[model samples]
Target: MTKYLVFTVLYLAMYAHAGSVVLTDDVVNIRNFEIGYLINSPHTYTIDEAIQAEFTPAPNRLSLPSNQLDIWVRFSVRNASDSVIACNIHNSISYFNRVMDFYETRNGVILDQKHIDLFAWTGDTKLLHGTDSVLPIHLNPGEEKTYYFHFVSPAYQYFEYLILDDQHTLAELSTKNIFPVLLVGMLIALACFNFLLFFSARYKEYLYYSLYLVSSIIWFVFEYGILSHYFGIYGMRGHLTSYGLLSATIFLSLFVKKVLQTAKFYPLQNLALNSTIVLLVLNLLWGVVNFFNALDISVYFFIYAIAVYFWVSISLMRQGNTLVKYLLAAQLFFIFFALFGILFYEGYLPYNWWTRYSIAIGVTVEAFILAYLLSHRIKLLKVDLETDSLTGAFNRRTLFDQFMQESKRISALESLVFVIFDIDQFKLYNDTYGHPKGDDILKIIIHHLQSQFPESSVFRLGGEEFALLFTAENAAAAQRKVSDIRLAIEHLSLAFPESRHGVVTASFGASVIESGRIQNFNELYQQTDARLYQAKHNGRNCVVM
Candidate 1:
């Protein structure tokens, strides 16, 4: 008799522990529940059968076994407060399950039933826009209601139910959604900036990157349900999502190829990129032909493309491609977050804000890194185009460009100074010491001027001749700065046996124009050239201002 009594008590305690959830105004997240699931069940059960089915206490995390099964979660909540309570039952994370039927019952009589088909084109308009399964209910004082959730999907899903007051739901959603929205906005801004760069520089890589960003933006917005919820765009979910991924693959490959100059540097990698692009184009066409049915296979194509990109990046990095470092870092970030998201979806990691939005967060980081890489590339290209290779001074073309730009900005308070100078006897120096030593002297002269003036203002205008452009308060200030430059050039004690002096020296001719005295660059150049001849006539290695 004692053994039987102990067994009975244990059984009753087990059932009681999984019994009704007593709800109060303070109860925000509901946890206690009874779950009964069938793995690959051959037959479906009716609502009556499901209501009478036996269930065990649910674990903290309930993982689905297979898509070919049914799951039922039951929990009864009784209002323990005097005032009416409005609550929402929904998944903690935003993910769509194919078929979710929610039922509210009182003593085996149904109060409310909702069938949610997330992928359907038409459904309950409110729920259709929602990313997750939501069931809102009102409980009067002392009212008890039993809730049942039945789920079926083509793929495995994990549902973590949350019961919260309406205000708490709003607050929680706002807190969760704010970062992703901001990240998307940042990505859009980056895309726009890249577009502008593409227009300004006419770089194919920038256009490809902008396109990649646009596709990624589309993918993230639709994947997270923002388009449907906020913008009321419900159609073309699958096609758009697949199109975004496919087009992103194509454009990113183009961007990498163009930026890395793979065809010129690494022919094999270039061929690989070309092949990947072709395959993706085929996949894109396949998607278009098959419609939404092709969406299931699009992810695999994307994964394969990303693997190719990663391999190419690593290979280039191994071959001493310095720019590949940024690409590799971006790839690693994306892969890490993508893997973490997969783990979260597969129930290995706990559901949290970071886990839920890991992909978007990673992509955002990757986008900025790539953008920085592109900007760095552009800076390097600009440097190569504008500067002399030997002495690191602005070339003749840049000299004219700078003068034109400065002309536009000159005002009544500003004066422009143009100085042209050359080595007093460069030909004799080159003949005596050979061209290489003459080259050394030219570099030294340019270096001396660079230390005093902005590098952009100091120009190597072919051979040993150079030009300097600067702004000053007045003519006196401009003359003082030019004299200082002449002195600095003389101070560079480079060997030049052909010079009248033992050390190398240069002659300077400067022309200053005050504000409102507008002279074109050619006129200014002619004036400075005349002064240069005057300086040579007066005495070699003197300043003619």
Candidate 2:
């Protein structure tokens, strides 16, 4: 009776000591765990050694520093159902560099074992699928098993484990992966659109934008494990990620320079942007030879680049650049999310959907905004090309084009008047005063002309010479308008020390195309030129009609 009692006591003690977890649902998140780590050590731990080693209770999520270390994590689960159930043991973190070995044992007898090393090149195509990292576990009613995970990595690690039904796990993983796939598709589409715009418009900025988008797509493909699923090459993931990011940065800097015309307007910012590009290129090269150190150094450059871009954008906006304001708003939105992503990666924030994909979201928003901004910029550039730089009036080319268009609609009901004017003794005035003062005089003349003929279109044909085209009811009305403008110029009495008048004046020549006249723009221009020459000969301050 004493022997039997001792045997019963031993059996009950064994049952009580078994760390079995009863599963009540399709998914079981095993959070109660313990972890032990060995730094710069060989992978030679046996089951007994692992069991005997000291382990501390892990937090809700385990994070390991980036180092050459091996980590051992222990956990157990039990089945409470009447029938046997098959489930998948999933390590939720899918970082590419990790080499994971899973060992399953029940009552000190090994039941199954599996190894997942993504860096290995020799594998079946399906082996590269991210889901293959999960281990298969079978449990009979009331059976308990302990699982040991031996993880080794050369990069920082995050750990979370789940016990899920095979079907449920597949469904969940597919649903979870859909988001990244959609993001990739969106990025590719945007890149293609920008490429098309580049070729169609022949704008170099669009080309740079497309290249930046392409690089971002490449980085996200590897970062999100989509490349691993298709290519099964994990060794290049880090290198490619670094290369893509650096390339994207370089192209983005170039795009900003072109879009903002930084060389012309913001020379200091341009120099800083170029310097960042050089640093990024050097960092990319270093990453090819020594990855971890390069990665560590790159973070500072990235921060610097972002700061410079932000500061330059703000400065431009403050200088009354309308396009830069839009760009600044878009960049602010992107920077906010980018900072969140950085904080999440550094373990300062919880890993939620927004934190996990914040950078991607920011990139999408920025891409769209940038594309719209580029189109708007193209329109503004067209306008600027048609305008005279010295005087804010239409250039000779634009004036001729407008005249031709207006000529097509000439009729008896509408009369056209063309007037040419120039500053009197302007060459002598320019010779006496430097070109800087000459420019001021020209600007003042344009301001006065625009103010007098607010409804007419004015054109700066050449130096100190301007033309105005207006619609009038009759020749008398057009003559009256030209006489008023000539009198206004004489009355201003602008001081010109070298001129005989001692005050700046203007000479005007007017030509009227009466109703039913079908004169071409060049013919009208010739007539106006002849009259202007006559006016110049008949004492420089008078109007010739």
Candidate 3:
């Protein structure tokens, strides 16, 4: 439907210079070829002088490339239909132009002139109906009018003229125009969430990613005219776009370095990343010092940075860096869609919804992918923190944490049991066979305890001392569980000839209490330890509860 409407409007606009527009109820919107002539001059011209000046046929897209010059567009409209026609002419490229002057004239007489100052915080620059650079035109039947627009800017400009009739279409268009900018807000919200997570995780990668998200948010705000259209902020547009991209690239490099562990595993790549970041920072500072016309330069550098980051991920993934795969997947999504959006702007792809809003879609997907990857990383970090390195048993700290958590639960219907045990004459066995053998015996003991209780609840308290905590139906059931663990350890086939049993064995001590009656982990630990002392005195391998 939109393509058909655009085609009909273009067909009428093509003959607009030879004849007038035959307005009808079906002509809801017109764009691109509405302007009849374009004049690119080295100096500004008044509306009176512009009327007599020579002009050339205007194309749908024109580039204004000089800060010292101005460009003017002139067009005429007539309502041949029988009813009054109300429509709006909007400059979608208003952000690229620092100053926009619209002149409405009839019969060589100036009737209305409106000025939009891009740098101003009030008046003409303010958002109207949540849109920008709009000039409402109302014409009665048989009325003819001519309109002229003057534009001045520092960098390249894309002038997209859109005319829409005032029949609920303007509000619909406003919503479509604002949708992409609202996606930037989603990125901003994700950045805030990661920033808060950084405080709890204390991971520098999270911090870097958060900062990168913020820079990306700023870049999109500038690139899509949101800064000027929504905030009425204009001057330094080039500088903000360039600097924001560079900043984002730097932080993304940092995030890749930390997440992939490049510094530890791939020092040369890490050095390359650092060197690229330094160069980007230097360019950023140079732009700040000089008037910041380095958008092209920044774009080139940004592409180079992305290439280097991509190489690092591919190289690391090949070298068995498991985390790099996720990074590569995320970057692929961003690069593919963003490149298509860039190509669309460069006229390589036909104008369509996908090509137009590709960047917003790309960023939204990549943000969520990175967020999930970060969450998975935090879970792995938690596992590493809780498990013992040598025997793969839960550490002492984990034991205490589990105790605290279980104590907080009010729905427990069973008694909680805490058991402490150690290999009989472990020191003697170590002195006789060696410390390596002693370590193996400790691993074996943990394995047997893991068979009885969960690996998460099997704790390695210290050298050769292990613990287990679980819920039991009663004290007798808890003692039976501890005895079963002791029997499993004794049944191990490994020989420890220095012991009285001529085989590896462990003494067990247990303390049981009703659920939700716990006071402190240390108190329970002390009670279990004293019973373990009694077991040691009673015999070399026995259970004391």
lDDT of each structure?
0.76, 0.75, 0.74
TM-score of each: 0.74, 0.80, 0.80
Candidate 1 C-alpha error for residue 475, in Å:
8.2
Q: Rank the candidates by lDDT, best first.
A: 1, 2, 3
The true-versus-predicted C-alpha distance at residue 272 of model 1, in Å, is: 4.7
Name the candidate, 1 or 3, with the larger lDDT value.
1
Error of 2 at 91 (Å): 3.6
Q: Using lDDT as the measure, name the better of candidate 1 and candidate 2.
A: 1
> Can you write out model 3's per-residue Cα lDDT over 19-66, one digit (the tens) per residue?
234456536576545354444555457778887776666554443333
Clashes by residue pair, model 3: none
**Which stretches of model 3 miss by more than 4 angstroms?**
1-21, 25-28, 31-78, 82-86, 99-131, 136-156, 166-176, 237-242, 264-266, 408-413, 428-441, 444-448, 516-520
lDDT of 2 by residue, 301-386 (tens): 88888888888888888888778876777788889889877776665665566776798888888878888888888888888889
The 10-residue segment of model 3 with minimum total lDDT is 60-69
**Model 1, span 1-545: residue lDDT tens:** 99999999999966764557667775566644544443325656677887787755564245543334356777777788888888887664324455567789998889888775656744553653245556788888888888887766444455666677767777656554556678889989999998998999898889999999999988887666666546655444533564786678789889889889999889988988898898888888887787444555666776877888888989998999978889988889988888877676666776566777788888888888999888877787889899999999888988877887887788889888889999888889888888998888888778767776663288888898888888888889888888888778777777665568878888889988887787777888998999998998988888888
